[model samples]
Target: MKKILNDPKRFVDEMLEGLYAAHPGMLGYTGGDLRCLVRADAPVQGKVALATGGGSGHLPVFLGYVGRGMLDGCAIGDVFQSPSADQMLAVTRQIHGGKGVLYIYGNYGGDIMNFDMATEMASMEDIEVRTVLVKDDVASAPAERAETRRGVAGMVFAFKTAGAKADQGGSLDEVEAVAQRTLANTRTMGVALGPCILPTVGKPGFTLGEDEMELGMGIHGEPGVRRGKLETADQIAEQILATITADMPLNSGDRVAVMVNGLGATPLEELYILYRRVHQLLADQGVSIHRPFIGEFATSMEMPGASITLFKLDDELIPLLDHPAHTPFFRV
Candidate 1:
């Protein structure tokens, strides 16, 4: 792959080193392990500690979300690979406050396995750990089995909602509940127009023709549900919103949070064009938009695509989403 790097074997390490160097005030390494990134000032006593981790290469995700009002810490892994169970345990300990800890991440097989192992390890040390798996991509599974869907851009909304709850001194159970609620209300669908090359493999993980697009592709280049000739942004937007709204029907007078997330390489101008259709569609349906996040909230490593995440907001959710949050990549 054509990338700016020296050693393929040292990709994760070197990438994290650059992340820390670029944002030391917001991120701190633990035990000299670059993978265990905690907020520079962690261990906020009497408040629920929020921690998330999984495969890397998705910037503003596993690492960029670490900071005030976001994640207390995160155990990072190599590109598109789950962190070791021991890594999760270490980062959990670093951020554990007296109130306990909540482990939140996307619903992936490896992530579930590693986080479960970490929970068992932490329990032995008297660290109360709760877990929430974000599964918001509606196109990944039938509505009857939503839990089987892959988590995508919608996970970022979960992080924001739950992190705000923790920052407000919510209990472990309370924080976990809010995160679960966020996931329940959130749904995402994506369209990939191009492929990305992994630094280690030295080639594109997957491929797509110039006139083609894959719908509902996962962040790690996993095959999406369908491939078809590319269409206009409005057509793609309408198709995705139809699936989302069908699965989670929006009622008249209902309010929602909107996230138009770029998969990596899609430019802001294009994303905004997509968002314009989303906003218009929602208005046409009589749904109110609250806190519309229109940017690269979650991303793949320079893949060209975009996803729309609609979070059905309620009274409890609106405040949590509105709470002031300051991270290196996200602020409000």
Candidate 2:
């Protein structure tokens, strides 16, 4: 339960302040009340604006993706909490280019409700808006209705694809189509090694024994599918990869992108350890790794865990993915 902060109540604001200070060229606050971080020179004339929002604990999820080739703006809420409708509308107003805006975020209830309200508000202003929800966590729901599954790290790919499409002067409808396609092709599952401490609570959100690991855990410390004795890195990778592959069924000659993401506290060395096994497993499946990104692309505070996200890419997606993207948190 150790943290460095002046006051727990001000943790969100203070953290945003520090982030802006560190990357002033890339981030800034909007209208003061709305915790909106937009590209310093946003509303890029004729391009459709891409905006996403969610809780704050997951670094690089909602905020870190705001950059030149990603989201145009992002509304950040408190840790693991959804932003208010007004906040979303403010970001929409700020980033609305002549073209319409697209709201791409997770399928969590709070986000859905708030973004729906925001969409209605934006309509009143004659600003067209479209929404896409990422539902890629196969472990959260049955395959018969996989769309009900929760969104995880796969949202990153959606952001990149949608942004690249918009950057290339695609219509708002076209950009939304690219994002939806990316989500449909993505699937993810995660394992938790330890719980994360909320900044306000100053205690672990949940408990896990030193020798036990939880499979299929949510990023917000939600219960996972199973708990068992820790196993070798290869065994763990196999378990996760099998679940993802079974749900998606990558065949021989299939090309895909792999994201081996750390929850939070898992170091780079350990993530690479897991990635080694993941690489071997994918090779054994005869699947070609198109573009591999391994790091803390998404995280839950200081939680110790990792997730695997697979995007079965097609011809169009491969180039959009490879398109140059430069952000503080992601670069290509």
Candidate 3:
């Protein structure tokens, strides 16, 4: 496998070190645990603290959103592995303003368990904790069971929405409420044309035929709902939009926030080609887009694919999404 690193065992550690080096003024760490990254100006005295985390390899995900108006702190784990509860606890302690802390993360089994353990640990120290699990990937479960679906790129909206509320000095409950609301209004579907090689694993865990694609695949190469021959960009876009709309069913007067996200290796030009179709599809349905985002908001190492996320907006959600944020990776 062709990878860039000194030691696979040190991949997570070294990556964090590099992140700090690249943005020293904007990023900092909880003293002993390098994995717990925080905004340089953390524990803002009066504002609610927001913390989110997950495995590494998805840059701008658990860590990339750390800054003034995004995550106050984040607990990072090894690639595709949940961060330890202790790591979560350390970040909690680092960013706990008297206003309390809220933990926002994707809805994965390991992430949920570890974050829960950290919440319990924080309660022992009298730190109030709240959580909002993002479960927006439509392909992971039936429409009747969205709560069971895995969170994907839709969380970019979650982080921005909830972080804006917190940055506005909203209480922990208020922040948590907005986080859940944002998640509830979001849906995501992805298609992967190739696979990614994990450094430690030394190879791709799953593979696709040269002329094949997997629809609704997870960021870590989790099985999607379908596997079939590669289709044209228009066909792929139609399949994704059909599946998402069948579940969510945007109406004629509905408004949405569209995100065309690259899984990792998908080029920006290709992403726009896909987004053009997404825009047209929504327009044809008479749905208005608020602000369309296009880029690699979330990734899976070097995997070649993309995911589309639509955030249904209401009168209340529009402002929260447009709130200004200053993060190392995300700015709004």
Candidate 4:
């Protein structure tokens, strides 16, 4: 790999050091372990705390969202690796306010195992803990088995919705409910043109042809549902929209929040081009978009591609989604 850095083994640590320095008082880590990061002003007494953990390389994801009106803490792992249960428990202990703590993260096997262990450990200490798993990648599983699908960019909506609820002083149950609701209404489809290189591996995790693309690829380089010659931006948007709508059919007067997310290396200009077509297609269906989030909300390490996420909104969710939020990597 031609990436810049010294000692691939220290990649995650060095990155955390820079992240802490950049954010300063806004973000801090538990104990001396940089993997267990939390808001600098954590344990907002009596407020429900939100925590999430997952493999690294997907920034603004499990870590970047920690701040006011978002996650209270995050257990960070190495690139494409799950954080240990001990790290997760450390974050839970550091962020648990008097009210309770809620664990919200993607539906990944490693994360599920580690987070579940942390939850049980916290429960023994008399700390109430709740969990909400995000599963919105429609291509990962059939509609009948959505719960088995993987989580992707749709996590942004879940974090925003649930974080707003917690910031509004909602109970733990209420916050978890809103997170579940947001994810239930969200669906994501991704197309990747290239793969990313892990620091330690020093090679691309997957390969794609010069004139090829994979539809519905996972962030960690998992095989997509289909691979074929590359298509136009409009065609890509249409295919993704068709798949999402088939899973969560939209009707006239339905409101939604659209996110055209860049994987890592895709430019904002290209994302907006895709968004332009998405807008037209949604308008054609009589669906009104309440908000259009266009940018790199989630990413793989230097992966060239994009994902589209559609969050079907309701009267209650619209306001929560619009609620003011401020974090290092996200704001509203």
Task: Please report the candidate that would top lDDT against the real structure.
Answer: 4
Q: Write down the worst ten-residue block by lDDT for model 2.
A: 27-36
| lDDT score for residue 90 of model 1 | 90
Quote each prediction's TM-score.
0.98, 0.98, 0.98, 0.99
**lDDT, each prediction:** 0.89, 0.90, 0.91, 0.94
User: For residues 247-316, what per-residue lDDT tens digits would candidate 3 score against the true structure?
Assistant: 8889999999999999999999999999999999999999999999999899999999999999999998
Backbone clashes in model 4, listed as residue pairs: none
Q: Looking at model 3, report the run of 10 residues with the lowest lDDT sum.
A: 60-69
Cα lDDT of model 2 by residue, 9-97, tens digit: 89888888889889888877677853887888876789999999999989888899998888899988999999999999988888898
Give the per-residue lDDT of model 4 (tens digit) for 215-281.
9999999889999999999999999999999999999899999999999999999999999999999
| Tens digits of per-residue lDDT for model 1, 33-94 | 89988999988777899999988888888777887888999999888899989889999999
What's every prediction's RMSD, in angstroms? 1.0, 1.0, 0.9, 0.7
Model 3 misplaced stretches (Cα beyond 4 Å): none
